[model samples]
Target: MHTLAQLRAGQLAGIQRLQLSCGLTEFPPEIFDLADTLEILDLSDNALSTLPDDLPRLTRLRVIFCSANRFTVLPAVLGACPGLTMVGFKSNQIREVPAASLPPQLRWLILTDNRVEELPAAIGACTQLQKLMLAGNRLRALPPQLASCTRLELLRIAANQLEELPDWLLGMPRLSWLAYAGNPFSAADEQAADAATSIAGIPWERLQIGQKLGEGASGVIHQAVLQQTGGQQDVAIKLFKGAVTSDGLPRCEMTAFVNSGDHPNLIPVLGEVLGHPDGVHGCVMPLIDPGFGNLAGPPSLESCTRDTYPADKRFSVDELFGIACGIVSAARHLHQRGIMHGDLYGHNILHCGRGRSLLGDFGAASLFAPDGPHAAALQRLEVRAFGLLLEELMERCDLPAATQASLTALQAQCVSADVGARPSLEEAERLINSLRA
Candidate 1:
């Protein structure tokens, strides 16, 4: 957020990052003054269309973000950066990503919400690649060469025109998080069974909304009070903001929440919201336990695929097993109900010190018949994600070698390259339960 005045006056020097949003229509040549020290540049939320040809002058530059801009093509100069590894051009008008636009060491790339109908085969050359985000685009097919990226982990390709997923999509060894909702080959758009049968509909007027609890791409969660007919009771409310989210549609999220059924480790959906002003969509949910907090933060620029936790945090072996058991049990139940909790990750999990935990957030969920051909692959895909989470938890546990050996063996089974070789969620749960005996 440094201002142009500070930069011009040399008030900012030897800084490694610079973010400006003054709506410049051209590149700021003044940036070169700190080129010797700058490692990251962010010019998002501006009217800029291109970068200077000598952008490589910043020899230490490694990450660049120009999202929400007016670029029709990825600036070719990005390819010349000696150390660049991450690039983002989200919500732009980009239609062309030249074969030469990618840097050699590129690891994470984001091109969400663009007009990209295709990706260049050159993308396969970046062997260091890990995370990729390409949601909300016109892509009909992904470059098959992407299959060569054995290290790729997190990927988002939702809201596209693909008729079918590539065969290799289910084979990536390190892949864990994946979102392909809103595509042709995906299951037909799903509608929840009559929600009234499972949960009541509460009038919005009868509830008092409070301060925001949290928010994500799909909606805002608020602490609320259910003005009961007899008295008042505390509750949680999720008021969805309509539009295409980074994941997909909010209505789809609502449908998934309503139909997810019930489980002890799942946040209870008390009812659907009714009579919202201006027809806003929402749901009534139980207030989460105050003792519970998110297990980890979302991925970072460097750890593009893994969750980040506090360095001081550590868990006992019993606590780790309890958390793992609760999550795997919930996942097995969801799979039985024909629901895919697509955004399963450490960030989406909450837990108390004693290993009491809940798996929440249905924004990336989708419906599929458990008997369908793709069902097996889908569940195994999530098993890999769970395995990664388990590995993380185990790494922080002060457990003995004998206990660690067994859990690591199970994780190895879950992340095996042969998707079909991965155990079913139910089987994985059973194995986890056995570990505690």
Candidate 2:
């Protein structure tokens, strides 16, 4: 949170990062003083509408964030920054993204909650791109040129106006995590609506709300007591914030969570919240054991799209194999019911630290017609995510030569370059179980 006063007084001369959000309406000329050292710049939560055309003067700048501002057009000068790779302009009024605005070395781009109608064909020039977030936009179609980004992985296009998923998107070899719910094509599906209504509702007055347990982009979880027919039951309540999250809408998440039925490695929703004073959307879930904890932390700035683990984090082959089995089984269960856990990351999994794991967080999950044209491709795309999870686990674990070879073999098959060539979740589960025998 660098202040304008400090920047102007030369107190922040050697700083590598700068953040000025105190109602900035224009770029401070003093910023040019740190051109040789500045690497990251954040001007979010401000009243800015434009940037200086000489922004490229910050030669070392590699990341920039200008979210929650008034920008209507992405500055073209951003493309001239030789070292800039990551850019974010979320929650702005950006309606136009000129082809020249995309950085040459771009790896990640976030444009969530914007009014973007289309992407430039020049996006193909960002062949190094890996992650793209375009949820809550007005996009009706994706350019075929996006196929040139062969290394791309995570993508979010939810709450958009797309009439159908792109055929090229289904075939992206490296694509793993994807959220496309709330689009024009799938929003009216009767199956999802039926699933949402099938779940029993628990009156809000019946809940004895307790301390907050945790929170994510879409909702907050809390310890609560539910009054039942014969007794009170301990539970965890998730009250959605009712905002367009990075993944999609809270309504979509609630629908997917309720639709995903009971599984050994999946948390089951007990019932939905009814008659809240504020009309808040929420659900009742069984309390998780206190012993359970997240397997890993969410991605950091440096990792970009991968989960981060504690420096001393380590797992034995047996433990990792057990975790793998549970996740694969849970994935199979979801796919069988036409759900795709768009976020199949370690950060979303809770483990008892002995191999037992629970997959939660349906904020990124999307439901598709089970027999739809892209069903197989969608499942396979999630397979790549699972495969990557296996890779992350393997990197932190110690395994005997033979056991390592076996698990690596299964992972290889799961992450095969040909989407069709990747083994189905059922097949992967079977192969993983074979290792135990």
lDDT of 1 by residue, 1-437 (tens): 98888988998899999999888799888899998899989999999998999999999999999999999999889999969999999889999999788998899998988888998999888888898888788889989999888888778887788888776887787777777777776646363233333558899889998989888656889999999878998998988866556676666676667777878888878888999987988888988878888888888887877889999879888889889999999988988887788888888888888988899888777766788777888788899999988989988988788878888899999889878888888888998898887
Q: Which candidate is the best by lDDT?
A: 2
**Whole-model lDDT, candidate 1?**
0.85
Query: How many clashes (backbone atoms < 3 Å, residues ≥3 apart in a chain or on different chains) does model 2 have?
Result: 0
- Candidates in order have lDDT scores of 0.85, 0.91
Off by over 4 Å in 1: 187-204, 272-280
Candidate 2: worst-modelled 10 consecutive residues by lDDT:
188-197
Clashes of each: 0, 0
**CA displacement after TM-score superposition, residue 195 of candidate 1 (Å):** 9.6
